[model samples]
Target: MANSPVSPSTNDDSAENAAHGKGRPTPSRAEQEAARKRPLVANTKEERARARAELQARREKARVGMEKGDDRYLPVRDKGPQRRWVRDYVDAGWHLSEWVMPMMVLVIIASLVPNVTVAYWSFLVLWVYIIFAVGNMIFLGVRVKRKAAEKFGAERREKGLGWYAAMRSLQMRFMRLPKPQVKRGQYPE
Candidate 1:
């Protein structure tokens, strides 16, 4: 103790620290609240227009990011590894649903024929196409769920995917957003 070079705390040191804005006491609740207070509305039209422009700019950025399939900007429905896998799985396959639109046009032309048999057959073919489309979608959903369960978990298997899968399958591949990353027949592992 006699050889130690220790200095005791002093009021002068406290004053010096305070002068430097170091170790100062925290502001009271009222003081903090006053600092946060702001006008409830914009004071001028220019301010409101500037705010709107900023919001639009933000939305445009997000829109571009989402189109590029950036995970950060993806809506909740499209975000997640599981959703990506499902998208890849759907994109990598050809669906009966893909032919529905063209077949409908063909059927429309066929039905316009003056013959009753042709009209009946054309409508019948359309009905069959619809049934096949529905079946393919059901099959796709089951496969997606099974594969997702194996790769992800049972929780994913139970997730409602029937409608999402059907909607994606119904869309023409070229028209689908976050455009198909995988080529046809290149199913995701």
Candidate 2:
């Protein structure tokens, strides 16, 4: 029994186990390489500074592109040929809504006068002007939509383009973003 080859609790430190690995299977070379890979984001001070500089450069480029109305850098809402056409159409025309804000301001000042008659008349005029402006905007929107459909094809026209054109028309030409590429009376083909 003392000379038996088999033992219940053998503590073998075999050469085979040492070569292959003991507790768990050894990882492949590819797995080891993958495990050593680092994340893309900056991890050190110098890397952080470089990243910030790159970001600023990108932002500047985008800003310039947006001002120039370059499609690549324009916001999603303002992108697409349809929007450009809408802007062009709006820029080519004049609308009464454009003066509504200034007139409203005048009306408000008039309403603040000490005389009750002047204030009451100002209020009445303001309400009438508001109703007229709203109606004018609606008419402008419909006309724009019809023209856009004719020029760009009904299928290609964006849904909210009418409202977009109308709103842009209501704004003073110089104040509109993308800077009203087409001058007044220079309609788009």
Candidate 3:
């Protein structure tokens, strides 16, 4: 046994390791980290300038795509077909609350009038309009949620979708992001 070059157990272990590649040496933590590390800033001025230009180009591309509502470049919140459909649905219809902000601005300007009668009237109008807008928003939210659930299924309906749709409805048609793919009165199927 002593004269033999390798023991029986050693031979069996080597055979098992060879079959599995388990005998190969593992990398050290530092070596692994070093391999992973990359220089964010390029070494040369020209290289740095090129990197910056490339980054700007990418950012511009993303901005254009996002504005166009391109699915590949859309944010996680706006990525899905359901969200797009919701936007289209909201855009195709005119909601009373869409004028709320502009009306509020008018109210504010009216309140600043030197005449006490005008200011008082403006305040009264503002309160009445706010109440009406709130009710309109509530109705819109309910309808949007119902439609979303019907089209996408209750399980597929995303959290905050109701609020998202309601908010989009509140914005002026021209001001909404991904710029109203569907024209007014042209609701998606």
Q: What tens digits encode model 3's per-residue C-alpha lDDT throughout 1-48?
A: 477586457565576576777576899999999999998767999998
Q: lDDT tens string, model 2, 102-177?
A: 8889988997889999989888888898788888889988988898899888997789987887788788776777
Off by over 4 Å in 1: 1-56, 155-158
Tell me each candidate's TM-score: 0.67, 0.68, 0.73
lDDT for position 77 in model 3: 81
Superposed by TM-score, candidate 3 places the C-alpha of residue 95 at a distance from the truth, in angstroms, of: 1.5
**Better lDDT candidate (2, 3):** 3
Off by over 4 Å in 3: 1-40, 43-45
Residue 189 miss distance in model 2 (angstroms): 1.4
Q: Considering lDDT, where higher is better, how would the candidates rank from best to worst? A: 1, 3, 2
Pairs with steric clashes in candidate 1: none
The stretch of ten residues in a row with the least summed lDDT in candidate 2 is 8-17
Candidate 2: global Cα-lDDT? 0.84
Superposed model 2: Cα runs more than 4 Å off: 1-57
